[model samples]
Target chain A: MSETEALESMVGGEYKYGFTTDVEYEDFPTGINEDIIREISRRKDEPEWVLEFRLEAFEKWKQMEEPDWPNVEYEKPDFENIQYYSSPKKKDGKKAESLDDVDPQILETYEKLGIPLQEQKQLQGIAVDAVFDSESIFTTFKEKLAEAGVIFCSISEAIQDHPEIVKEYLGSVVPKGDNFYAALNSAVFSDGSFVYVPEDTVCPMELSTYFRINNMQSGQFERTLIICEDNSHVSYLEGCTAPQYQDNQLHAAVVELVALEDAEIKYSTIQNWYSGDEKGQGGIFNFVTKRGHCRGDNSKISWTQVETGSAITWKYPSVIMQGDNSVGEFYSVAVTNQRQQADTGTKMIHVGKNTKSTIISKGISAGESNNSYRGLVKISPRADGAQNYSVCDSMLIGQTCGAHTFPYIESANPTAKVEHEASTSRVGEEQIFYLQQRGMDEDDAISLIVNGFAKEVLQELPMEFAVEADKLLGIKLEGSVG
Target chain B: MLEIKDLHVCVEEDPSEEILKGVNLTINKGEIHAIMGPNGSGKSTLSKVVAGHEAYEVTQGDILYNGESILELEADERAHLGIFLAFQYPVEVPGVTNKNLLRQAYNTIAEEQGREELDPLQFEDHAREQLELVDMKEEFLERSVNAGFSGGEKKRNEIFQMAVLQPKLAFLDETDSGLDIDALKIVANGINELSGEDNATVLVTHYQRILDYVQPDHVHVMIDGKIAKSGDKDLAIKLEEKGYDWLSKDASVL
Candidate 1:
């Protein structure tokens, strides 16, 4: 068999996101350099400070090599072979693009996911940039955000319009030198969502309404920053329930959040990238760095993520509590099917008096996949009366799959209270039978049990996102079990 | 409505050891049949086999529901064909709420029947009414399925589920066990209320206590792997007075 046929046949009804999009891509020269970074910043009309930040991160990234500490095995990504930038566009095909040649696989998935026809064309990157506004719903949503004093746009646009806020809070939570992937993302990161909720105001709606309109093909290395000022509340959503088909074999992204005095920020992500075939050939290597900071007294920051894609995923969405009486929470549900491998969890750092943190991590593995929860909870000496509670649970679907949990706890203050609980459960045949006897087919039975197992984390998502996340789980597990 | 002829069952097709040895039973519509037996006499096994449990394999037998052989059907397929089994010990599924399970099951059957499915709001009202039939509160629907439920409550939940599905034929395995007199009456009342001219019920139990509440049209005592004697409700009373020892000699005959 030809190599292309083998690759095409690898994706079927099981894994959703393996289609090759036919859009035109304007690529930079294959490889990374100082000139490439400068050209990237210049093309976006970035300011001088942003250019300097990219250069500094590029220099530091040159001094670092890829780390191999995560409990996952894959062919390491070749940095030299990777093209640094790909901004997809077709100048002349603006009109009638929605009616023609969107990949039928992509359309079928969107149809099954219940996405509207207009939005399906918009999400598939079929040149819906301007003509998709025939209904003006997305335009009205943008106006609503503007009227509510919420700044919502791409990160590059934010760099141009709101540079002061971007410069002040960018990388303040996760600096450029934090890790290898973050450094790379800082150097050549493309566009991602940027949200800012003003003080004394609540964002009118979840940020998905804004993201769904401008959701273009983010090829690789995306960056996001969200800031909630004093007494403000915002729930920001990243990624989508739709399957993301990318030609790039490697993905690196960075996300940072900041919450100030009496503010609350809830961040949710549903990542459904491609995870290759049963034998684990040609899939994405997802390495991302996400962190949030409760930087003021009485502030709260919560991270809820549903990760069900990628050939190999390594990330720890962490929270640092720096203000007295602050709160941090992390709720995650990570699923690995076939030969996928995911090593993910969170870190909760208590550095202030009367600070508290909660972490809930649930991992599910099916086929021959492997999933692990690695987390940490730390309390410093100044954090008197600080409290932390963490629970990590893993559920295995098939006999060949594996689940592991590694929890670390450190405390320097005697007055602080820390608790950790971990459990590994298998999806027993008996459990599946119980649900099946109630009229659900085998696939729906497994899906129901999995959703039930991850209910604690799934309910943490915003109202609309919670429903989509549940459906995404069901879609991922279709035909996975006999 | 249901018929089992010369049935033989074992744990995963192991020939040397069989659980059900040449058992035969039949039931028409609208009748309540009681299966009384001692411990390990294959009462529960018979119910599970009829329910198409994966733990048991039917090496030689034919189970017919509505004049069609159902041995080749999956458990879920049998369930859609109006077969229901209330387990002796309902497994505690931690994250699934009772309401969610019932709604999903009800809608699945309804969808197969080409009936309009109920939304969550409609299902809530429909399920809460079943809760009243089992003497359970609305809060009971919010808890996880059988998780952290007391023994009596689990049995009652099973009956509550039967009320929701309203199956054409049901096997209540040990439903009378682990229930107080008041709770037993509630369960008995629920069973009697759901049984109509279109459906049938088979009560698999050890004691005759539940028979006092919902009188059965016939009583059959299972011993070893097959039924040894058959009679009316008075036979259950006689077995309660004289222990199962009087039926042991008759059970060994092939």
Candidate 2:
């Protein structure tokens, strides 16, 4: 067959994680109101201060409007038709004491996703906080983390168990009124991971969170917060997936991070939410607001993400370099295929003197899809001698796909320097023939070229994730020949 | 070992304009044949067609390897069947190290031949031997496949790949185009060492400079997409001295 025909065949692979599990669950009525926010806070048994925080955020969300600045085009989400909260029905509302007490169906679902529930069989040296629907099912290796004075648990539990820490850092980096989605997430956010690394101590193992949206018509509003004390280091990973549905689902999440003096935090995400059918009829609208604050001198924060799913994705995991000699980095690889549209990038804000930031983004578009990279680099007057470097590259696979880059740089300091480079290229016939002449088939050649194009960002992921991301790109562009 | 009968080929973009019109040639085992031609004489097209390049349509022809028709095979399929082509300007594939590509290509051919595939360690040892044959440094294996290499380095890499694949029918298409004197000798020497009684070589060039290093059993002067004259190695020297005008005029009269 011809190369073009083979590429067209790539649009037919089904989403492997699209099967819904049969689990009995309770969900709130569709719509948002003050009572609903209060009920959610009461269900979690949050303190009065936390309840007041949600109430104030809900008031702001009621006055806010969804922004349309992103380049992606999608139907406006109907807030009234979405279930803001959903959770698996439990016996007498008791939390699971161990893996055995958790629902068998939920455990099976995690197993099918290649996440073993047994601690021995789980990924070695990695603690996981598995969030299903609106609640954390289980958290592994808590004892090991607690031995080092680290706090890792579901945000709901943290609000009740560690209210002082939660109240001090919550909404500190990403305030409740930061953006339209962030405001919504702050009001009725369900469950997400919360981590705290102690001063001068490196976390013994990697911390991870796996989020799954199983209930139909339920919007997943998860809020994640992480704090690193002075001289501490932590690496966190996040992964998400959802079952297929004929109606669109909304996922608006907020992630806030804080790094103290000499602290370093690395956050990585592999978003594989259900991307809908080939016609783009039903899929998740992933609009997320994630940002980190380098609060002390010599602090560092890096965000690395590989986004391969979601019909329409709009997110910018950004950083604020508030401390002198702080470093911020963003590396991303976004792939869109079969009617998917993604507009994602990062924002670097330099506030203190001698701060530095780097941004590298790679976008791959195939099968009539559109991928865009939009980023901003800003240096305040006080940030003298600040430096920023940005590289954005896009690779178009077929004739119908589109790629765009939008970069904004503003520097008020005379010594501040910002560099931006952008390029767009297509997989050409000559590149395919060159590999073919060396005994590689069409699919293999396309995978090789696509991986090579995204190597700069893929290599930034952890070892296991780097391999998984490579295979994910191959599957997403199975037969596509650029 | 290979035969081409009344081959008529044209660019797929404009098939009516034939680039190789009714060409015929043959090469047996243990033989080296060199095709010399001027510009636009279809020398490169002939080699590409033999290697099953998809851009060129074989309108009326059949290519047989070991008495089996290979006109319908793909380029990679032909490579697995012991057909190799040394490109004039090898394409650069960034981010794929030479060692990684060579291991893949070598194992692909090895698996098809019912031979045990080499593991990474074994392949590294095997590839080092081929690197020495091309006078290449061990560091070259760590570099991306031909990316950012000089003209001579690319040529040497092509020969190095040829030495590894060990094809029975090898076509060197303008392999000496951008080589310096030292590089040219190394490439020629590598080709000579790889050639034996069980394999054959076809050298297509516009100059006779490469022929001085590797002797040819037969030299054919290709004019207007056909072998207008065939003789011993002296034919290349004559063409070098008299130019293709004499051969074209002689063929037109005949």
Candidate 3:
């Protein structure tokens, strides 16, 4: 066979998580409006104030236009043809009380994804909140978290059980009108994980949320919020996967984090949504808005993500250093392959004196895909003695793929220092041959090279997530060499 | 142990431009042979072709290993079949530690031969023994494969890998090109330690200086694409004294 043919065969491994679950579920009718928002709020049993917040966000969303500045091309999604909300029906109006109470098919799906939902079958020292479609199917280790004064539950559950805390910090960091997607997520978002660590407390376990979009026609709009109180610490992980479908699915998520004085929040995500087939016929269009606010002195917020899926991804998880001596960090590795396009990086806005921020991003493009790292660093005049460092690197696997870097730095204070570095490289054929001659096959060689290129960012991920991200990257670049 | 029959090869991009024209050679167990030639005499091409490099097309040739044709095999397949090529310029693979690369290569060959694979601890112990053969520090195993290594260090690493792999038919392609006297001695010592009567070694070099440490049983002078003269090690000293111009003229007259 020709070299190109061999590469194609290597990368054409079928998506293992493409099977759909046969579950009795309900979904809203196609399209978005105030009535749909009200129906969603009513179904969730949200309080009046929460409904008012959604309505206010909806009004603002109607006036906002979708941003077109991203370095990606696709037929714009017809929002009117999408179902805004979907949920699996509860058994006899009761939530699953135990593993036996859950639907066998739904449990089987998670098991197939290698995520064991049953407490006895789970990995120790970690709590899992499994969000399927528009609702949290189950949350494990809740009682243990509650003992430590940590609130780990679904957003809808938080709103119902701890309305005062929820109302105080819901949109404080990322306001409703933050962006077009943020506003839309604010209006129609269903279920996502919520965590609250109390003052002077360190969460005993790693909190994670596994999100699966199972409904074929529904768009997943999840709202996640994490709050670390003064002198508190928490590490949160998120993993998402979707079944394969011909029609594009929309996933517009809003994740907001708040770190108070002396608090630290580590947020990591491994996003493995369906990236369509080799021809790019169907996949998810992931438009997400994530931000963190260092609201008190000496607080730190770090965002680490390994993105390997989605046909067109447009997201920049940012940090706002609003307190003196605060620190913010962003580490990302984005892999785009087989007609995928990703325009992603991070934003660091320094607002207080002596603030610091660091950004490291790695983008890998293969098989006609385009990957871009677009980042911004802004230091305000009041941010005296602020320092910022940013490095963006791109790796191209094949001749047809393209990689780009766009960095914007703005400093109003002479005392503030900012440094930016960018580099672009291709997977050289000689490198592959060298490894091949060492007895490793072509695919193994590519995986090693690509992983090494992204090691700086991959190492930032949690232990288990690092392994998963490595495998996902390997799968995404399969058959990418020519 | 290895034989090349009427080998005619060319650049894969333009197969008409033959690099190796009807070249024939044979080496048996317990023999060490040196193919010394001038620049662009197809010495490197012959070594690469024997290792199954894909950039060259063997239009009319057959490479036999243990009496079976190996022309159709991939480079890694040839590697698994006990064919080792110590590259002239070793590629630097950053982020892959020398230890990991050696372990993978060792285990791959072992698995192919149906030998039990060594665990990490066992392999580490085994690799350290080979590291001593090249006089490399223990820390060299922790560094990336050849990345940031000096030219001499890279040559030492090539020999280190050869010691660990223990190939039956080893090809040292210009392994002495960029080495100081100290490094050259170390590399030659490692090669000497690895070579035995049970295996054969082929040294492709442009100079005969390396033969002082690891003597060869036979020396062949290559001009254009074929061997022009075959003799004992005295041929290397003669070529070194008279230069390759006389050999080229003699081959042309013949």
Candidate 4:
């Protein structure tokens, strides 16, 4: 049977990447230690300080305990059973210029996912970095991007080519001691996107990265770093998917952004990782750490994400505004179905005078799924005139599902102003009746209402990715109502 | 075009109490029918039964649209067959845009009938024309579907959608209950313009004023889960002249 037909036979049958690749790699033993860290550093040819940082992070990860605060149930990850690194054998050599030159099996995997792996001469101003398994497969549109003074390449390449830039801001926003998953990501991260926008440059086009989890024996830990200089602007899109498997896969990634004076960074994530089976068994365990920092005056950082897959999701793409007149915004729509659970939100920290932030979150829970919106907005004592507005809404499609919102607001500054509004409601029979009265079928009507409910977040996505995201969430949520 | 024979419905979980008890009604093409009754008298339930609301279980009933039964159809299926219901209370969808939703809904029915789908520009033109027919502001299309619309704006939007969809059997359930004079007339006028010779409408209201704007071919006084009286437009004026108590007293000592 074809991959689509095979996936159609699997539980829920909507995810297209239920097929696995057939490439052999020299896998590391299932374990983590100082030796493993050193081995990864040695394999990647990293600088001495970077290796030292990894060792330190691994030690901290050992000291930290796994977080139990999220409303998710899963087996505790066994550090001793997880192989730290697994890469394609050919990646030890030079990157291929075309898909034909790459491994046939790996190229076919990309083709199945509808991603064009071959580098196009005319890219329409967008640059792409494709990551397969635990390796940076290829970084396309390099010369075109370099001509515009835009640094868009893999993080490993950035460490080799621009060590000073990478070293100065590697873990500044999200430190190695931040959380368990983040520390693990720091210790064994393989490869992810690294972008830099020079001063006064608009960066010309969007930068995209497609992440595929191909190695079934080893979990994938990827790290991404983006920095926008003064008066510069850039929008980054991150897409992730994994091959289906009977054994649940694990994905832990770290993404950090730094916005300098008068600069702006818009980060969009469309996470369609393989959600487990129809019986809600053997899916991905997605624990991610993403945070952005406004390091200079008048800087802005916005995060928009549409999360619809994964059996369990634990993530909160956060922002810290430390510059005067800085701004932060977060828009997210998380849908959980068929026993999936998500405990995700953001943190907006105001440390500078006159900083502001706006947060809008919509959660849709169906089919016995549990979804929560948990966030914190803290205004420090020095942050005079800090302002914030947060609205969190949840829509429950069935009686068996549950939706919860937890907002933590702490303001030491007397002059700070904070406003928060939250509501939980079900998709009522009357609402469906109203839409049907307008000549819509049950599926179309539900899609329309849901698209509207997540409009705030969907509008935040790039125009090219919005339609696909809508269709992805809509079709997955069809027939999900009680 | 619309007929309900011995309709019996109960709240899905509560099988003991029937909301609509053996109700029978018929509305022909090009005709206007009004069903007015006191609260809990099954006026709204009758409208919901014909539109296939999932919350109301049809224990024994046959709802026919153009001589074809729609009891087994989904809500949207009934709608595509030209059934429309202007809800007493509209729903609020925060993130979806009014224009995007309306266009999608209109195109779905059109496509099901083998009609061409409107391009974005063409959709925008249709949307503006319909909004103008309801006297709604042009900016309403850009807002999230009924997210922050006022009471008047919400009712106007219902009429606006009705005008755009142009169903064959329209059900205006309490369309004028909460509207001010201007909003009421605007809603009635939009409904009046959308009604045609080949299409039918059932106006369920509590007052005779809305009927003055959109005169009905027949007025139905629904009392105690059944039609107590049915007559021409003048009967609505009679009900307006005398309170609903008159009807109940004429039937029995209430």
Question: Regarding TM-score, does 3 or 4 come out ahead?
Answer: 3
DockQ of each: 0.66, 0.68, 0.68, 0.68
TM-score of chain A of 3: 0.96
Residues A37-77, candidate 2: write the lDDT tens digits: 88888877778898898988988988999888899898899
Provide the global lDDT of candidate 3 against the true structure: 0.88
> lDDT tens string, model 1, A1-482?
22122112222245543334344444557778999889888767789999999999998999999898889997777787776666544345221234343435333433333333344233321111111101111111444578889887667768888999999999899899889999999998876767889999888776642111112233367678889999999886554222333332667878899999999999887676677667786566778999999998999999998888788889999999998999999999999989899999999999989999999999998889999899989999999999999989998887888898989899999999998888888888788777777898888888788888899998998764565466567667776665
TM-score of each: 0.88, 0.96, 0.96, 0.93
Model 3 per-residue lDDT tens digits across residues B1-254? 89899999999999789888889899999899999999999999999999888899999979899999999898889988888999999998877788988898889889998889999999999999898999999999999989899999999999999988888889999999979899989988988888899999999998889999999999988889998899999999998899999988899899
lDDT of each: 0.79, 0.88, 0.88, 0.84
Q: Give the clashing pairs for model 4.
A: A11-A278, A452-B95, A452-B96
| Rank ordering of all candidates by lDDT, starting from the highest | 2, 3, 4, 1
lDDT per residue (tens digit) for residues B1-254 in model 2? 89999999999999789998888898999999999999899999999998888899999978999999999898888888888999988888777888888888888888988889999999899889999899998999999988899999999999999998788899999998878999999999998999999999999998999999999999998888888999999999988888989889998998
Give candidate 3's error at residue A372 in angstroms: 0.8
iRMS for all predictions?
A: 0.8, 1.0, 1.1, 1.6
Candidate 2 runs further than 4 Å off:
A1-14
